[model samples]
Target: MPEPATRIRPMGRRAVLTGGAAAILAAAGFTPAQAATGRSAGKATGEPTYTLTVMGTTDLHGNVFNWDYFGDKEFDDTQHDDIGLAKIATLVDAVRAERGRRNTLLIDAGDTIQGTPLAYYYARVEPITKQRIHPMAAAMNAIGFDAAALGNHEFNYGIPLLRTFEKQLDFPLLGANAVDQRTGQPAFAPYTVRTVRFEGARPLKVGILGLTNPGIAIWDKANVEGQMTFPGLVEQARVFVPRLRRAGADIVVVSAHSGADTSSSYGDALPYPENASTLLAEEVPGIDAVLVGHAHAEIPQRFVTNKETGAQVLLTEPSYWGRRLSLIDLDVRWSGRQGWQVVAKRSQVLKSNTVPEDTEIVALLKGDHDKVVTYVNSPVGTSKEAMSAATARYEDVPALDFVNFVQAKAVKDALAGTADAELPVLSIAAPFNRDAAIPAGQVSVRDVAGLYIYDNTLLAVRFTGAQLKDYLELSATYFKQVTGSGPFAPDDVTNAPTPTAPSGTPDYNYDVVSGLDAPLTYDIDITKAPGQRITGLAYGGAPVGADQVFALAVNNYRQSGGGNFPHVSTAEVIYNRQVEIRQLLIDWVSAAGEIDPVAFSSVDWRLVADGTPVVIEG
Candidate 1:
């Protein structure tokens, strides 16, 4: 994903061969080392052989300070307690200790910020004191983050802020794809050659290049569109891989914030997560391995052979917000053309069940965590109706409406006096906090946080009628006709293909949009193209315009594209502010007690043309 913003797969907990994943680690033929840990890289090495232990995280989504919102006082999810930076730091230190100094490198693929409440709090109020430092960066700096790359979410705060972090960060931020809005220089260093000299012998040069999905223009239009341009992710990787080799990089590892979507098509075009066509290690001369992120899902296999190259490409992604840390051990054999070629690789999962919590780091983030406690748990306005995020599997939902209501209101609240306030606000909401239906009952602050576990702000993006069609096309990716009736059958993204098993199973794949009146239907064949599925669309009893400009609201992630919607890529943000929608939900609850159930039916669709399924625009 060369786009400034970043993007996932559907992965959840299953019975772990847990110990084998941790205790019985395999590296070519070596016996597993005892558990202790804890760690980026790319290229054709031209120098010497070396083994670089790569430890990585994707979609940390600002879980740096642990989670104050999901505290014991709120609920007993336990997902947060053992899954924050403090715990990750402990594991990282131990891993490095075993590998020894200079042999280990810590890198992040992308999506590091904007998840937990502490991150939101720090972004707005915290001071960078001698002791009270910027916790997220402070923790990364403390944990010895060797390098990191950007995610689309990074732009949610805008380029000025991103540059500020880039300038102040202690670790080098590398990226081959991110071009500066002003100078066209690589936004961060394109790549960095890290030299590790053990026993003062010849130093081993490891070249690390980072790539972010280039779709940032659509997601963060206000922050990046005019200021920057993404040349192209795959093409950029093609150009940079060789450049690293020429620069004398012994071992190369790519920290890609991009992704390969499970979806095959969008509108009439192929929807790719990052550089879908590019498989660098297999296609390029000197490249060895790649660490991927932005999908926020964990992939455990050591190697997924590239079909095109017969080259074994090693890829790893951990769960977002500190739920998991991925460790990849690369067995590098020295070569001449490329100094060190990673001949073998293996990965492990550091989960809460296997690893105990690191108490010290918890204490460090406690005060900041306390502030987080006050922010989310503290009562805001109340709701007279029950605003439960509870909904059934694969169904149009009210919780989504709840999410939309709060987010839209938050944007309106943030932009109350600005000229942009005149524009109608629409929020794009998704179900990250999916669970079996919420029993009609009292909703706590933590519960609201759970409704949208990812800490995201509200943003308003401007889109023309045509752009809206593209956006819907992207949304349609989640829905596919099961009849094989040319995939043109009626569909909703939330439903499971197979009916419920005897196990009374659940499917959490659905996403919902709210704020517009609807009686919408997509009767046309969608899979044929964008205009196909949307057989019918209207907002408030009227056909949508080809030229109408919409004031659309979305949580920072989707606006930044966690779901891969189209035209959303061209979002010209009319409302760009730092108001968290979760807090808005708390306010909504206090004002009304509970939300009366509200359904966010589809309100718009693409027009079919001549049975060819063409979606027309202004």
Candidate 2:
């Protein structure tokens, strides 16, 4: 079956309607002048009713297929099997077919680009700027997206690349809260107007206002610090919702790249909250529905009532990586007094694996996929011995040591001539992917990429001895307390499955400290409380003093307070660049000629339960 056609009319020169009675007129094939004059042939007039289905997808981190290029296999997480845009395409078609094509609107809530090997290959290896179209733009265009909001990760590669990406998209990339530093005007269009015409009912004008997380200011400060400013999500929505209503929108939908968490990171210290979907829905007046993202969570539906007006606002979030599709169904009736009001509403989260992968999307990007597969398969270096992260959570592994070596070397090179060059340096890292392994012999780009799966840049920060000890203690909390002498299971040390109240520690939060010599090795006792888990910490054959100072090699995410690590974000930064750690690994491996596991590897940390050996079975 052919894809449904979508029409998105920009509100260019329509008469500004400020009063409650004033309505914006928009329909297919209607010009701005005709809409403003209210003379369009199919304009909404008398009492009429209709249904509108709003479909949303968010946090599609460049998973175009079910294939995992790094692992060279189909994507599977063991628990839930569905993933990628090809799966999402099937659901989109089904929903559009069930509802009238003209009444269904598709929207995306950001984090669209820059995650998988496919996206990274296009962005770094073969830039999309040189190519005609980005794979993301091509896929989204083929799927007929009406509008999209911006996410914080979108600014990681810099504004030039983001501009190139925006130009290739068929839909409007809206970020109403992202304002220019000098002009204070929206850098991107604040909102988009979609005019829907039912068979015999009045035209329904839906306005989509886009709001992104304000953490972009801190996370991507290098790229967007002075160029653009991000205000609070609720603050921006308050300003645009009224304007959208004034412009004749009967229903307003907010495409918020912020998550549904109501907690405020700034806590009155700053006006902008990092995650504020719940707050926005409760505070904003004119919004009918909100599409939330950026936390990578699944929330089918949540209704928040405005305190003053007592009006209900519906919110929905589809899980990340195109695993699910969020649908919001609205039944509206035309009232002579209020124009159009939603009388009934329903929502559902559809699984992406319910349908087959869209062959059209797979065929459209075949050349790009093949190029990435070749690039990741090509050998870059040789490993003298096999390395694996299987036991990394319980003890140190060579895979993590290799990463630390690269990070420390990069920091040393970056601070070569700086004042802090002579300071003692310690590098910290975590095993991101537990299943990652490297066999002895030729090592390909895929092996290295799998080891460091995240897109994190290197950073050098100054930390006092006390802060370093605190950091290690925080890392030790990943292990659960063992009451009696018994064989410990692997899952016991793992964090609580609930993300908000994680128990022990996550593999990503387990820090392995390098640059410490013999006699300085430390052990973690899981029987103690979280803050007192670290024992016998020493450096250079002596106990680490609280007043001692050291330079730490870390990632941008940790340095920016991503996991709520202690004192790292406030530390004095000495070196930072746009370079990614994975790329550095590739460069370091290529320059070293050969990697002998014994040269830079060390077993400096281990997990023990009350002076007893803890068996780690992998």
- Count of backbone clashes for each model? 60, 4
- Candidate 1: global Cα-lDDT? 0.57
Error of 2 at 495 (Å): 1.2
TM-score of 2: 0.89
When summed lDDT is taken over every stretch of 10 residues in candidate 2, the lowest stretch is: 21-30
Candidate 2: C-alpha lDDT: 0.78
Locate the minimum summed-lDDT window of 10 residues in model 1.
Answer: 6-15
> Candidate 1 clash total?
60
lDDT of 1 by residue, 383-422 (tens): 3454444442233456666676666666667667877766
What local lDDT score does residue 353 receive in model 1, on the 0 to 100 scale?
31
Give each model's whole-structure lDDT.
0.57, 0.78
